[model samples]
Target: MHAPPAPPEADMLRDALELAPDARVRPLSREPLGSGSVTGLEVTDPRGTAEPGTRTTGVTYFVDTSRRAVERETGFATGPSEAPDARVWLHPADPHLPALAPVAFADAASVLLARLGLAQSGPPVFVAYRPGRRGVVRVPTATGDAWIKVLPPSRIAQIVGIHSAFAHAGIPLPAIHGWSQDGLLVLAPAAGAPVAEALGDAEALLDEVDALRRRIAAVAVTHEARTGLKRRLDWYASRLGEYDAAFGALERRVRAAWREAAPTTVIHGDLHFGQLFQDDDGRLTGVIDVDTAGIGVPADDTAAFLAHAVASAVLTPAPRDGQVWALARAALRRWDDEAGRAQGFRARAATHLLGHALGAAEMREDERAAALLRAAASVIDQPAGTLGAT
Candidate 1:
């Protein structure tokens, strides 16, 4: 079943602050973090301001989408008995609350950069942020422009290790200058714009992605790497909440179809053009955001790339003439030919596309969103080669 709407913002704030009645909280800012998950708030306290200019700390509220309940600890951790850094869980009372908090990220970036000796006089510009997942910022350093990344404590090692392995395997990656135990990483920028910018040049995009796939495939799927859910089925199962009964059925059907054994390789758990950086001259510069990288069937990454292309085309007006769409289809076909698992590729892509449609529908209620949802449904049962054929 789908979760209920979020709670009220004012009530959440009142409840959260009530826990620390003595501490004067000046809310700096708030914004939405995606995945239908938690929201972040940047708050300042007048009492015992820590740094010279830094007065705010980030408060993240975890939303249990399945229960529509905010956890209790964070909600109540602000009392006089609790320390400033004590974690708390607070449930929001309404849907009008802030979804994301940039100030918190700004503070974090500032502190981490200073520690790394990469600090600049100016503030860091945010590239992306998700409350509990990750935060990315672009800042200047002595050597050159660098990126500061903050991720969940659990993912730090995997990300660092994967980048090292990819580099050793001859796959391009951003240079990792340093990382902290707290999940903060400093990196040198990868050359060129994202692959999404060059999707119109089908030949270049295909050649680059194919080469990327081959190199990644060369890495053996280690036992430790495959520790978690080894298939996309689990990922698909987690997203069925937004769709209707028909989608749920389609999901099950796709899952059943892929019961057979399939070839496995080191797959980019989250593959999309945004994750790919490419040069203007038809070459891949690097791959970023490997938080979900793991051992999986080759079809997983291919499906993810195609799904995002369709979602992008559906949501935007550019990449017209079906150029990007055609290129994505061709790429998948080539992979299937080489891997001998075209059917698996098509099936998994179909499942992911369906989820993307549901997300689009929920996120934007416009005609474009509607069209994409319909497009996804129409191709749900079709072969992978037939995707975006319309």
Candidate 2:
């Protein structure tokens, strides 16, 4: 059963801080971080949205400079005072999320340590960034790393789906071991460079993920076979009759355009520059995270790309000024060459336009979505034939 909603002020970090023997509870910053900040979901995620759940760990450590204080602050150091077969450790956050206070602080601290290459491994290497407590962990064993990713046994099917999809596609993603009884998904060792750090060597990295994506696409079922949930256009249209109507109209136009182009395989739902990872030796190692993996109109992913490009564009009315074409061309090359040359430049082109149009409209991005619609509208009025035409 799904967990019930939590209280709006359920301050897990403050509670953990108060519970900790020596750690100090610092209040959060009054100003909240913006939506598009480099900070991750932990900071961005507001409190009360989280369900009440406790993860299991045989050990916990409090990070500090003084050994005696660390021992005192971190709990269960081989004494009778330790809970029956349970141990607690005092873990401190280096830079807490000021808006969310203690939790953010701990999360930031952990991320800093991970990026710096500290506690990258331990026996049961699990890193839970819930609220408060620890800042980074360098586990001693791979076993711990595996335990860190434990998931539910029922979701093994989803795990199996991701694993088989990777194997069939011949991509190198994290391996999925069976889940422990506690429902945590055990995973094989992951060794790769973070995608953000790999940006300097983009050309090579793009080629790598492109090849991997095709392999993924190869095993993908067609759109007709993958119905229900929400179609590319339907997602936009459904929201049209609600809080806004622009989204629905845009969805209709994008749908018409999509029908003119045929889609063949499933595309990675969130494929982008940040998704790729590499090894220390500069080898492109794996594609991480495929929970949204499924057969989709390539244009769906394409739309997300366009959204990012436009949103990040330095100038407005990019299409008129020719910048849109320039960026689109670059994205097309990556989609074409790196994306395994799927042979649908014309259809994909139309879909790309449609994707952006529909998305902007749905988002009620009044000006941008309208502009995209006008761009498509300016070029053609009626779609000529059944989709997937040459």
Candidate 3:
């Protein structure tokens, strides 16, 4: 069994507004409290119990740079309505769980039911919400009706940009009717199964992803201003340096990247299976989470795609949904063949591999970290690739 966290950890260290000036405290539950699971304790005054009246459903708490991490595992939850303070809440389940949010707001997901008016209601289930990227919710819309989405793009210009690309491609994606700067997005749910559950074979999924890629390519912005050679090297070095001490050789590797001549292109910076939606009949319907779509090196898209590709491999039990090396190679090959960049895919893939490698090292799974390092090592020795060898 895994060891328990230390005592007095309290989990939370500080609050943004000092608990909004002490009138509130970051709500948290300890391991001992909830069957060894640290759930957020959303309470009312005087008494607490989990009943229909006392039980709060359809609520989630978001913990980011902005909110306090009251508990190590769970953070602040959304009350009946969105708020910044500790108040009485009646949340059905945690929004941190994918399907929880969708289920909670099933009544409010008005646009979804109307769009698929003819279809049967898919009881969308909540799979594990991938932590680092976004909380994903998988629902059954029709036979496979479902949707997968990131909260929103507040850090960068990701969501709006991708939504526009969907429109340009004539692809049917979720309609972004409501969005907040903090990444809270209220989108029109898609009618399909999560590609994760719908597709039976990786080969078929890859083909669908490839076709989807080409369609998006039509509307891709080609005139993106490339950073000059000197500027590029400096930028690489600066970020590498900032990350080097933690990464070991990243700083040195970035310094050498200055000499490489890599081309750039437009891509959905992050794309893969998780962003995809498929019908129960195996028809891939819509792909959401396109904000990372932008003009960058071709390999950037490949790396992002492979990130999900690798994740799929880890998530699936039997014959895995995909393998990292094969999927990455295929995505790269397609970018080079149809997208017009010969070396761009290789260079960007190498760059993405490095970034993903560093982050992967911190994962709890030793094998995952090892695999990421091995793949990244293949490219790291290339001037700009100086992070380290696996």
Candidate 4:
């Protein structure tokens, strides 16, 4: 996928910060915070200014430049109400929206990890940064490299609990070494590259996904944990007003095909090739980004895998009619049959693809949403058996 758009006001803000009179403060990454309304521009300073109210281990010299930039660019003051540490700033262009402070929060994550005894003395390297949601960093530890995941404070317990439960269940997840009072979660490095980078033969890929499906099914959640997938679809459809008619038709189709007999299991709500990692030997190494995992229809994971493959193949600049699509059809066939004894599996999968399309549309990614819409149509319009009949 292409990189996220750079914030328009970032260059001027970088020049205005004046953190170091001689050294240049450059923008590292611009992440969208809170529904694309707020933009976070992570900047670096040579003067080594510590962020105000950061009382943790180690010293992080990069100040939260976003706060100052936002206040100056847009006359709204982001007082103490946004966050306890005031680690948030209003969007520079839009006065109403709020975002994470334009500091590499990963630096703070590193310090949090050190206190938890997960890392040693060196500065942490940025592994991934998604503004307003999470910032992941990698730190060198005495044992090996450990990853620090910094997310919202409210979900910390849920994430830690999920990790513990998954580990006890023998699922192939990274070992959770420790967690901090703050929202930082420290984990051992996952074993392989994402499937987007390492696409094995179609057969091997399908086999690996099958293994993951089985592991998810092994987890026994209570009935209260189960939630209907339709609820999620409704949320997306409501947000995409332009696609209301199309989503209405899809909703009807899904309701007609919906079967109460379908077994509910632990499902990765946002399963996709990018979420999957596999070893060089084509074995499923482990699954990352399990924050979205919960109870849902078992076939939902298979649907997600298929939907992502379809979207990627169609949206890429150099699209390929790859064999993975054929394999995806085969995977769907198995779960579809087990759940409803017919094409009910494909129905659920189609519904998910449609939901994805609506989501893309809401993001104003017209081309992407259009591609996903067409992809979903192809699946929904055709008979399930015809998927790989050719």
Candidate 4 lDDT over residue span 5-89, tens digit each: 3334454443334334444333333322322323344444545334454222221212132332222323223345343112323
- Kindly list the per-residue Cα lDDT of model 3 for residues 264-342, writing each as its tens digit: 4555556777777987666778876665565655545554565445444433455443343345445444454434233
Point out the worst 10-residue segment of candidate 3 by lDDT: 29-38
Which stretches in model 1 have alpha-carbon errors above 4 Å? 1-61, 65-108, 119-121, 140-145, 220-249, 259-263, 319-321, 336-343, 364-369, 383-386
Write the residue-wise lDDT of candidate 2 on 80-124 in tens digits: 432121222333321221112221233532443344343434232
lDDT agreement with native, every candidate: 0.56, 0.39, 0.44, 0.56
Number of backbone collisions per candidate: 19, 33, 27, 0
Worst 10 residues of 1 by lDDT: 91-100
Residue-level lDDT for 181 in candidate 4: 44
Candidate 4: where are CA atoms >4 Å away?
A: 1-103, 116-146, 220-228, 243-251, 260-263, 317-324, 338-344, 384-390
Assess candidate 2 and give its TM-score to the true structure: 0.42
How much is 255 displaced in model 2, in angstroms?
A: 2.4
Candidate order by lDDT, decreasing, is: 4, 1, 3, 2
Better of 2 and 3 by TM-score: 3
- Give the per-residue lDDT of model 1 (tens digit) for 1-390: 232233344245435454344443322222222223343333434542333553334443333221222222333333233222223343222221222232235565566666767655566676775444566768765666778777654567777888888888877888887886556678888867877765657656767776888788776436333323223345434444443444566556566554343546777767778788876676788888766666666677776776677777665565473776676666556655534354465556656665565444344343554465455554445554676655
- Score residue 154 of candidate 4 by CA lDDT: 59
